[model samples]
Target: MSFSGWGYVWTAVMPLAVLLYYFFRKKYKDQHVASTMFWQELMKEIKASPYLKKLQHHILLYLQLAALLICVFALLGPHLTSEALEGNEFIFVVDTSATMLAGEPAAFELQQELMKEMATQTGGKPVTIVTTGANPEIVLRKEPNREALETAIDRLAVTYENAKIEQTILFAETLIDDESTVIHVFTDALDRSILANKAGMAYEIHGIDQPLQNVSMRQFGLAKTEDGIRAIVQLVNETAEPVSGKVILTDGEVEKTANIQLEAEEELLVPFEQLPDSPVWQAVLQVKDDYTADNSMAAFVQEASTRVAVDSSLHELVGAGFRSLNVEVDLMDPMQLRKAGGSPLVTNQTDLLAGQMPILLIGRNDEKTHRVAGAIETVPHALFTYAPFDGIYISEIYPPFEEYETIATIDGEPLIQLSPEGDIAVLTDIQLTDWPLHPSFPLFLWSAIGELSGTDNFFGFFQPNEQRAVALASTRGEWEIYKDGEFFYSYIEGQGAFSAPQEPGIYEVVGEGKTLKMIVQLSNEEKTLVQGTSYRIGQAEETAETAELSIVPWLLFAVVFLLLVEWEVYRRGNAHR
Candidate 1:
């Protein structure tokens, strides 16, 4: 037992002295009775029952003295402690990673429970709670509000991001000026080197101390084939031993099952051939693992559906290239087609030149009037991914502009140029130039079609960036955002862009009869669950003081009960008299 305000303890002596003085005083009253003999007889009866009579006379005195003692003790503010807080400060580092979602109680839950226990043990000392999330944050700071600390712990939640443990530890160290202050970390066993960086720091690690052997689908993809789409799923056994599992692949209402056996630390790729036109495919692993976050994965097979309007004289090889690249081309005379983002016009027809959209003007076949000239290719382009640009020859020259980006040059002329407006790509006549026979012929066209198509630029995920600019086809009056199928917030429709959410998950932009999907995923390192690896980095020689609860409140309650008992005794005695 300890007294926080021991200076007031000496005041108890004043009340004690008063009680003694009153007890020693004489009590007398002058009264005229009917008979002195009756009074004498009553006194003799009181003496016969001395125990009951004495208690009645002394009850008030005892009550007053007990109350005075309690008041003094209360003023002193006493408490119990097994160990002293030498520095009078503690820092709690919590891990909020996807891996913390594992284990029976979950590592995050266990960390919260430990924080609650520590809060109860605190002797009004300063405490701070920090979370090692993708963006590390200090949930609670140096304050003695026990309730607030508990509330902070209750609010702690796991994130899909990996634990930025080292950065968080370094931050905690900055808050510690006293050598005796202890830093308590609540996390898994993965990273502990941060503790060792500090030569002499008082630190203790409280880990979840459990292992979760997991089978995860690291990657899932789909490739377009001649017959249909091919689905590929990659499974990894993140364990020390071999594991057996069943993979259940679902395409719409159709289902397929395959048994898999993986050796220690093995990775297996399973492919399903000839899938239907299902836009989304799901692969689930039927295995009992400690962590279930990565047990199932979703992959989409979005085939390129470019609307390429080609002239009747267009070579059959051009159509074959579009098909090989999964492009859905519409064979029609260029004169009958209207240009759009998804629709690229490919024709030598001179009648289609009067449209508003930028034209991909192809030169007339004049081998005698024009000569092949060396060409220059543009740097930093998306179309260069699948094909190499050697050079293309042009027989006829067209007007060149500084506002256009040359994709390929024809005999010192613009063979293929992207207009600064970003809606045009022009090429010279392939019949007059030997460019069609080049090895990168089909690949270049396939890539060019992707650049022209608006679908190719839709962002897959919103990560590592807070803001993004979107090119909406039509900017209407109202646009709204949805999170996990529920309406979240509204944005001005004319803004044509949206800010990324702070939390990780799938978000959707819906309005004007069109919907766009965006995903946000955390760092992959945090998703990998490596259990049973928690330990302290630095060990201090000094022993930490264990906190013990004070019984002062219970003692005060007893004093109240005693006072009530005394009140009843005095009341009953007066009634009898």
Candidate 2:
């Protein structure tokens, strides 16, 4: 407890008025007009004071004194120094996710305002500006200039992906000071999971006012169907009001627009009867709104005529082998396939023309067969091939064979080596002389086919030379790993994915002896410039806890206490009246 102005204690003199009132209070004696009994009682009741009247109303005197004491304290400017231990190092977390774009003026607007307020409150203390989203990034570290911080805040843009608040919080925690540090999080209330590890520091949450009206295209994809290409699009109307829009689809030349209406908080499913046969097309929702990013999307449809053309013998042999071994294959002849097809495949012309598949050309001795085989490869399928009879008297090599993968031979010759998706089991330049006569020929062929046909075994599960830790939750008591429908390994409950086979391939994870269905694919889009967002901080709500003592202003409480005492004193002085 302290006083801002000790000299103002002189103001305490005004409370002495209570003493003066006690001294000057009027005294009266009753005169007996007719009743002698009343006169004698009044004479006996008269009390004597040396220099003042006896205003011995204890409660009123105490109350008056208290009110005057309060006034003097207010005038003296008394203040309490709490001596709270606060960290000097500051971490400023700002949310920049797609959901922040909702509402009028947007939730990010409040984020901008908070950045300024935080700057003022921080009093030029060093601050690290952390942008939160799917990929939480640190824009500036330990910045002192408020202007520079404000500029960074205004320049911040919303991420298309959702924010990963938990990971960001963990990252910020790493930078917290051991002594005293504050973690100020500015965001629309996302999720509270991010608060799990906030043990060491103080946290100030600045929540944004977000608008609820929004319509978003949540999911969209194109899948091949028996009738034609099947297109599925999903939309969610997040707004309370009803929403209506036209879904515009275009495959460059051909365009189809469908009207759609979605109730608030409702999901709408739009299915295309016939998908466009173009290689590069776009799906757009023509809804009028401020946010245009989620309104439209671009897609690359696989080619139709493009295929992995195999010789009749190899096709029959490999197709039967794969079926027997449960290797999935879509077997069809290019010429015959087009004639019997119900709808065309491969619609995006810019990316891949119709009727094209990435080809895996095998041994073709004749020119006619070679042309037939080369035509199936897509024009730009990133080609690699090997020859069985290069030294033999074969007339013309195929034209597209110019763009093939090769290596220098021992004789300084360019021998084509096979490296399909980096699997080493298949060697490309197998000579015809070695095919029927070599001792290792049968083993080599079996290995080559197995390696070529088999997809990357460790693709979805593990990266090359990477040891990743994974925790899988299952309802069953036990879990198992499977590759190509064969059992690999099993583990007890609460066991991590570390002990499972490190080799990567599509692994079917089964729980409790029942197959838990999930598919993992090698994501080429993972390297794109845009990263996904994550939700870390959650919404704030009133909890069933007592009010914080720190929130009450002591000066205001003192003033109220004084007023109560003053009221008692005033009432006592007026007793005679």
C-alpha lDDT of all candidate models, in order: 0.67, 0.50
lDDT of 1 by residue, 30-119 (tens): 856679898898789867985566556676777877777887887887777765443457899888777777878887888888788778
Candidate 2, lDDT over the whole model: 0.50
Give RMSD (Å) of candidate 2 vs. truth: 20.8
Q: Candidate 1's C-alpha lDDT?
A: 0.67
- Tens-place lDDT per residue, model 2, 326-412, is 334455544343443322121111121223332234433232212111111211111111212323222223222233445312222
Per-candidate TM equals: 0.64, 0.44
Considering every candidate listed, which one attains the maximal TM-score? 1
Worst 10 residues of 2 by lDDT: 373-382
N/CA/C clash count, model 1: 3
